[model samples]
Target chain A: MDFSAVRSVAVLPFHDLVGDTRAADRVRDTYMGMLLATRAVYVLPSGEVNRGIARASIRNPQQPTTDEIVKLKKELGVDAVITGVLREYGKVRSGSAEANMISLSLQMSETQTGSTIWSGSSTKGGISLADRMLGTGGRPMNDVTVQVINDLLDQLFE
Target chain B: MICSTSCSNRFLLLPLALLVVLLLGGCAGLEHTTVSSSGNTDLPARLEEGALYALLPIENLSASRAPLAELDMQLRNALKERGIRLLEPERLETFMREQRMRSRGGINLTQSRALRDLGVAGVFITALETWREGEVPRVSLIMRLVQSGDEPEILWIDGVGRTGDEAPGLLGLGLVKDVRQLTAGALERLLDSFVAARSGAEPGTAAQKKRHQPKYRYRAADFDPAAEYRVAVIPFLNVDTREHAGRIVGLHVVRQLQRYGNLKVLEPGLVREALLSQRMIMQEGPSLEAAELLAAADVLGADLVVSGRVFAYEGDAGESKVDFSLQIFSGIEPQVIWTSHSYGGGDDGVYFFDRGRVPSAHELAGRLAEAAIGDFAQ
Candidate 1:
């Protein structure tokens, strides 16, 4: 589980369990934004990663197998690979109170050994005290998403 | 030591008059709509400013069969005005014809490879999602810039939705009376945002976010006081449209329904999976036989199923409008328990001026869904 030697990582598109087809790309993009801000790891550009995916014909980029992970590492020239699943993304309500919510989990694996190194999940933003008292409807989706990724990154660095 | 009655009355009236003036002043502004830009703001840094670009034929998703040639023309002019380089119109036309390119709004890798042959650096694609004509026009336009190479990638994607009366200034001077003006304004705003983002300005520079307030209402009888309800929202059926209007509206409804603490709304993916497993198809419309509804509810472990159709979702002018209806069925009895229809513009609740206008069909749909599902919270 030592993360000292990890350098560049390719973040594949997150699998979306939310019915909205657009959620996957949106969530992945937001995650990348926050991840890039951390300066903890060098991430491969999404364009190159997507090109590699198409070249390899990886059918399920969200759940790449070990063989596919190795192939992606060879194709994208990255030391590590990251994949994720978006369990929830959008709005939720508790009685009359409403707020934006997102639930997602991520896993990172070393490309050479094809061994899972780090894993984390985050769920945040739902009917906060402010939403209940002041009826503010909580933070916007973008803000909530930022917070979620921040939480996951915090866990990763810790 | 006593002041005259007239003097005391004058003093009181002056403050009241100022208060009235201040309130009215808040409502007195030009009609304007805010554009929210997301996606890769870092695109500009990677793009060569002087590189030649190509504009794909605009995609029209509006219900109106209006000719989009004028809009395309305007787009070309707008791009040129911003000093963005583009291929010659005639050359571009001939290339599209020769290549037999029918695609719009997006450019794939193959297309990008082909465009690269012409020494194009990037491709600009636009979609006109809503175009309505009336006293207050509404228009929604989405534009994307994709770099053309072995790996075609979207550099920037932004959308602007505006209604003609979005910001009627003092005495209504700011109302966008013409669709052309609204369209031009939207394009300008989008390009400005892109430029600002590339120039290292605040990428999140967006208009003030306004919260949706309930302006309309439809009340159902009542839920059993003691019994908790499980709700399932299914895919909405689209009528006379090529757009994914149905799914968009359904998501809005799901978002609104989840705001209630008493209802356990099932994830839509599970509902879709259950339907697929049972091989249930409601292709014609969302209407289902009572038995079919009950079967779906049973598999989803829900007490109610929500389904509907999108009739009209237009925002191509100055006032965006959404028209859709939803019906709820009882899981146990296959009986219809609630039905509601919503059809209105983004400017529905604006009183004095444009302060409360919505300006986008997406946001308006969310608010309307909130109104239709308002009774659930009670």
Candidate 2:
């Protein structure tokens, strides 16, 4: 697959399958940073696309179709679209710290071809300050999310 | 041989008719009946020692990618730790399978019947939304208690929690982490309210013992209608940007408190008058001096004063998002008797400006008010 041609990308608001506002925010920020790192690509604002998708009720789907994806791409005006699903959002109590975990899968598709070019997923865990304050080393949710986003971007950009 | 065959057919027909009559008689006997005894039997009134509750799988209303199972488990564990008896999930699963029940969805009536048949005193059901926004994970959970044999009476509690900005490390780490944190926090609040109602103790009571009595211990007749209890509702502060949100929320609190039917609800017009006479606007914060405010209607003699803050409101987008906390104070001295917080929202923003979305909020308020009244009666 020729990745160089995918210079202009549109980021969709990460759909929260888990409905956790915090996890959604983390994924959005991480994806924003990853897109920004790709200087060659022009990324559209996710909020605008999300608003349009929501207004049209196309973001929520039992099974999204190719035509729907293509339409969304045309409406949002982007050559490629980055979409992902949030799989999990939770915390585990370790020794003395609580380890928060978040998992996501990202899929990039070419609007014209209607074909998925790249797909990958990552899960990251972090410890909170409360856990560290209690002398327990735990990974915070934010740290793990950043790492996962970086890894996913490296795979796609490389 | 012809006569013998005819006789055999008659015999079979007679038996069939008899069987049909017996079946019809049995059906007729199943009519609703009530039993009354002239005198109360001295069969040692056994106090209900403890209640066993079964929490069914919570229906996921948000996106499908969320870890809903883990969140349900977390809530179950939180309730179990409070010394409340909970039915094991595996057992529940086996029982549900035996009953040919596949999903918790559309099982509201069936579930109530099953719990009653199982002889459980209470059943807990929940609905959850787990979603990610930006780098933060948000979880919205609504838990309710349906008493056995009580068709319409339900106690509801709703809560929302968010995880700090972070991502998942493993295949299901993020979902699990967010679910656990959010469910745990919600369970804590719910258990606290449940325990408080059961023991008639205020929050932070360490030595309270579980009361082994039925929920409806006090009847409406037990309250003295002649005794007028002065009640006041302070202006609920609005944390959200919605204008007049505080007044609307405050009115709701006042309405719920008045519904007790035992006490006279002070008119909203009179309350406004009292505030004006005191040179106080609704913009002012809650007042602790019940005596000063009572000059209009004997505030010092008030049995309870309800006050709270509106932390959020339904936006113009139709999302039913709202957060409010309430506290019931006893006497003019302002001693806290009971306190509760409720949060509600949805993704489509359709919950706001919609009466249907308000049901969840109303249920929570009713439960909280019931608890408050239970304390006063005790």
Best by TM-score: 1
lDDT, candidates in the order shown: 0.68, 0.51
Superposed Cα deviation of residue B119, candidate 1 (Å):
23
Roughly what TM-score does model 1 have, to 2 decimal places? 0.47
lDDT per residue for candidate 1 within B1-378, as digits (tens), equals 356887999999999987676556444433335555444534557878689999987777665665599888888898888888999989898988876667563554456788899999988877676677778877776666777777565566556667666565555666777887778788898788767655655434233223332222233344462367777778777754337687667656765654454666554445655666668666433332422453453465677778766766766545667766666666655444555456666665577534566767855665567666664455
Q: Deviation in angstroms for B271 in model 2?
A: 36
Question: How much of the true contact map at the interface does candidate 1 reproduce, as a fraction?
Answer: 0.00
Candidate 2 residue-wise lDDT, B1-378, digit = tens: 999999999999998987765554333211111110011111112114466777878766443456667777777787778786888888788767876765452233445566678777656656553343333334444444545552412332223323322222223243334444544554576566555445433222111112211111112223343456666665666653366556555644553444343554444333544555567643323433432355333322356555555655543232335555554454444333334444444321222222122222223323333343444444
Over 4 Å off, model 2: A1-158, B1-48, B98-110, B150-152, B156-183, B201-378
lDDT value, residue B308 of candidate 1: 67
Query: In model 1, which regions exceed 4 Å deviation?
Result: B5-28, B31-64, B67-130, B139-162, B169-378
Cα error of candidate 2 at position B298, Å: 46
